[model samples]
Target chain A: MTEKPLLLLSNDDGFDSKGLKELIETLRPMADLIVVAPSGPRSGSSGAITSQVPLRCSLVSEEPGVTVYKCSGTPVDCVKLALNSFVPRMPDMVIGGINHGDNSSVNVHYSGTMGVVIEGCLKGIPSVGFSLCNHAPDADFSATLPYVRRIVANVLAEGLPVGVCLNVNFPDVPDLKGVKVCRQTDGVWASEFAERKHPHGDVYYWMTGVYVNNEPDAPDTDHWALDHGYVAITPTQIDMTAYGQLKRINDWNWNL
Target chain B: MTEKPLLLLSNDDGFDSKGLKELIETLRPMADLIVVAPSGPRSGSSGAITSQVPLRCSLVSEEPGVTVYKCSGTPVDCVKLALNSFVPRMPDMVIGGINHGDNSSVNVHYSGTMGVVIEGCLKGIPSVGFSLCNHAPDADFSATLPYVRRIVANVLAEGLPVGVCLNVNFPDVPDLKGVKVCRQTDGVWASEFAERKHPHGDVYYWMTGVYVNNEPDAPDTDHWALDHGYVAITPTQIDMTAYGQLKRINDWNWNL
Candidate 1:
């Protein structure tokens, strides 16, 4: 029989987040689990890596075929360190989040949780990022378990193509409408900065914004699926090359 | 004969980096500049936004047709603020960097310099990021000036397609090898954590590593061009959609 798949888990949320614990519990029995989460929260960290600074990791727990480390770095750093040093072998799959907030549409790029899985896909490992739309720390994952298992098992069963990964987001409802493969929605965060005065009489502006989705009617999109009742699964790739514009760009011909 | 193009400028190397100063000096004569950059360095801060905490900004300098602001955030944040509130109208182009370090190959994904330009492109603005392969704070910009001016003028003379941006990197040398339009070279940063003992006897791991590019022989790659002493110009896009894998992924039929 083939050995169980080694699963590496991580998130932008600190190690104490309930979502992390639940995800660990759910994944522990199924595969060889190794977690490298932040010592403190690192939400919206995106793909930041500590270049000029050194990153520190501390071991908090270990058991048979399972270990946990609290890292002092971004989600991308966590995954890089795990792949380069911590793991005995490159992981069969890398999973991130079961996060507290929505990372469905444009949020994926700004999410440290999703960034690592994206990094994993870049390194040719099968990867998936799971996020619950609700932002409550104690958000329930009871409804998310079956979907996670189904997707992870499917990925394990059917390996992903090179340089591709999955961005899976779940609706907040306890009753799900099952999973739907969708594309990223043309959505963005609209900014509304608030001006405030500090005690020292310094004027400061706070960057505040509300999630304003531009494609509400596009049912084939991740945003539409999650806004409805479905668990949204969007296949994401790392290649940023704009193949369509290559010809026009090539015409620039710097040699001119 | 028309009004000078309104050009938005930013960099990850803070406002003081000589590369940024050179870029500002080079373009100041030809454009109406709106400079917004981080208060301090934010090099590897890719796609990251200031969502959790509020952001603040201060006027750095102002001399008719030119306004520079220093913000307490990453490059992406600066662009977001400018697009949302700080600008009077949409700028003709958004240009980031003359960055002190290289942001070639896979490093583009972890670069705050390129992140701002990507954000600008997503906002439907023509944008480009300029980086010199030299990491020295005082890297010579003479080699970079002609390329930057040429690319910016070209991009301005003919706007980029929606969602298209450029990642331009120059080799740090006095000699010239011309420029090559290329695609992103597949590479990964192999992170090596430096384990250190704190004065209090606590174990800490610092993130450190050099990027070892494996796609050395691939002639059609950015890494190859940079190695051959040619400047690499890669047109980047915001869509992370792996259109090639869409059908195969949908075949999973999550509807089951």
Candidate 2:
């Protein structure tokens, strides 16, 4: 009999998120799971590490094949601590999210879910992050189960290359066509802050933004796939180098 | 007069950091500067945003050519807030750091300085982030001033490509050769967490790690340039896509 695969799981949302619960339910049968996630939501912490304070990780639950810990750090910190101290051996695969919202396009750069996935890839582990297009805390994740299971099984069977991970986003619609391997779309958030007066007359602002896609018509982009009600699997990497422009920069005369 | 070109300044270090002050003193004469930085140190806040709370930005000081504000947010937040609300018009260029520590190679992924620079570039403004090899809060930034001046002047004169920005690092050594446009080195932190006992007998851990460079012999990388006492300028971009692997991933049979 084969030993069950050890899977490291985490999410950007707090330990108690509905998304985490659903993910645990979905992956627990196929793997020996260990979950280490933030104590609370750390939504926009993209690959951020906690250097300012010491971290406290407390074991919150332990079952037959599952154990969970709540970490007082960012999503990346959870993975770091798990790999460095918690797990006895290298995990077969590392998975993050089943996140409460979409992490496609420019959202990939601002996602704590992708942060953990990136950290896993940087550590030479096969990793993937799963996010649904829905943003509600109680959003239905029933439609994502089959796709997530298939992807997870595939990644475990076929380990990803070094320095690469997958950013998988499922459309919110019920009638899903299929999965499409795509590239990250060129996009950014056009941010706007809403000003409000405090009780003592001091002013504060809340950040609000719209995701603007620069290449809305690109057929091979993750944004395009999701917009058309298909699951998007974008292979993400740790190398942020723009190799295409390297020659252009090297030719510049830096005589000053 | 060229109306003293507008320059936006920010740092990962707190508003009162010596590096921020030095940056102000160095760039003041050449530009109309507006400073929006965190109220306290926010190191390692790589592209983090404040979605959980409202941000409070208060004016700290004002002068003829300079205005400073302290923000209750991370470095990325400071830049986003400045772009969306504070600046009457988009600044000609955005510059981050004169950082107290190095942001070369893999450090770029974890840098709040680079976070602000990336945000600026995403907004289509020419941007540059400068860091020294020194990590001391009181590290002498005297050697970096000339290089910073030259780089900033060049960036202002020759605007960067639409999605690209600069990540420049200077060595701590005084005897510098020249500047080299380089690629990001392949490197990562081999983290070691120190276990500690709290006063109440609870166990906690502190994250500490040593950066390990995988390719020390690669002379074309930022690590090589900095090790050889030359200023390394790596033109970075907002796109995290691994285009080379796109075709390979697309060939994967998602037969499930």
Candidate 3:
């Protein structure tokens, strides 16, 4: 355990993504880094699997303590294949995505980026998802790497609890004030499809959205952290128990 | 609102699945049921989109109060098309699956059935995913109907809080047992690929798993409830925050 922990890295933005390159560059110096990620963009592919068909993984790079593979599958697929046979052993930690865009608040549910991290946490492994609040393919990640490496080092040193991981998002800014330990903001993406006509005049809609964060004034929220130029770290877990609604839903389902 | 609601139903198990049929039959009496599941099995398709090309949704059936559309896309796609234009107005309740499998515990992360529910929750619509712990194509859903209907009724009577939905699971058993409103069990699917050689001698790994609930004896868990023939209602939310570890992670991310 004292050895440089074998850290598995992945992302939704695919293997050649700038985010992955940045992540690999940052973490490669710290520990044994095993990078396995989708070869093509798998954004919004929330934990999907190509179950009916066979999937493939192409070896991309390797060094003494660094190895990378690009998978023709979802982000979770990369994690699974790595866990199954790609890695020399079970990874000490799994870090997904210095993501090309933010996966804060409700975005985590649809994020292929966070899906791999959640996959790792499901097995009780420490995991973290790093995201920058910039969507461009060549988004500004310089401001994000220092925080990503720092969080990874800390998690590696002080292991996360079973089923727990961190969803870290940074504001796309030059002068980050500090970091904020915040909760997921209460927000929802109202996806409005951009309707268009094809050559044959058939109508189709491209899915697009404006994220609507209803509760913005909440002091310690991921949205607030990003707004204030602080790295937002929301320690997330796979605990889906709606503690608030358990007894409230008793009237119908339980009475049966 | 007082009208018998427009119910959009789907499942990952294909349109012709027994679970889908049962669910449609169950909902027909209560609501204007619009069934828009995938054309073929989409068991592992989480939140994928057909952005590379245009997709199709063909009308399969049109009855008095029930209509079905077989879509060539993921569960989220079906919901998107419906929410965008296929339906007159947004569905009142979006129910994904009286699924032929359990989506309790960590399976939530891998479920296309639950993916639709989460999308519905994001859109501020009440959603529920009812799953039976049965994976057979001809699994009997008779045992699960009452609880399913009850939960649906309760949700309609009192809508879920925005961004939350009910993930209901039933044990594949005979006769009656009570329901348990519980927390997500600390469990994972220990998956191993069934490596098979094709006629062309290419080896492919088919995903298969064994459910390993580490907290088997924990009474308040979904796993325990399902094991005891009690229908387990896990009120799942999209926010994955483990609030206790936030400050620690924040400080760690900032220190570097």
Task: Give the per-residue lDDT digits (tens) of candidate 2, residues B1-256.
Answer: 4577899999999899988899999999888999999999998888889987999998999999999999999999999999888886889999999898889887887899998898898888999999988879999898888878888888887778888999999899987889888999988888658888999999998988988999999998999999999999998988777776777767766655
Tell me what TM-score chain A of model 2 achieves.
0.97
Superposed by TM-score, candidate 2 places the C-alpha of residue B102 at a distance from the truth, in angstroms, of 1.4
Between prediction 1 and prediction 3, the one with superior TM-score is 1
A24-65 per-residue lDDT for model 1 (tens digits): 888777798999888888888888888777777878899987
True contacts kept of each: 0.67, 0.70, 0.70
lDDT of each: 0.84, 0.89, 0.83
Which parts of model 1 have CA positions greater than 4 angstroms off?
A253-256, B199-201, B253-256
lDDT per residue for candidate 2 within A39-102, as digits (tens), equals 9999989878887799999999999879999999999999999999898689988999899999
Off by over 4 Å in 2: none
Higher-lDDT candidate among 2 and 3? 2
Q: DockQ: which is higher, 2 or 3?
A: 2
* Positional deviation of residue A23's Cα in model 3 after best superposition, in angstroms: 1.1
* Residue B147 of model 1, lDDT score: 76
Residue-level lDDT of model 3, residues A102-216, one tens digit each, is 8898888878888888889887789999988888998878877777777887887788888788888989998888778889898866655666787997666677767898888
Candidates' chain B TM-scores in the order shown? 0.96, 0.97, 0.94
Tens digits of lDDT, candidate 1, B30-58: 88899998888888999888766778888
Which candidate gets the maximum lDDT versus the true structure?
A: 2
Alpha-carbon lDDT of model 1? 0.84
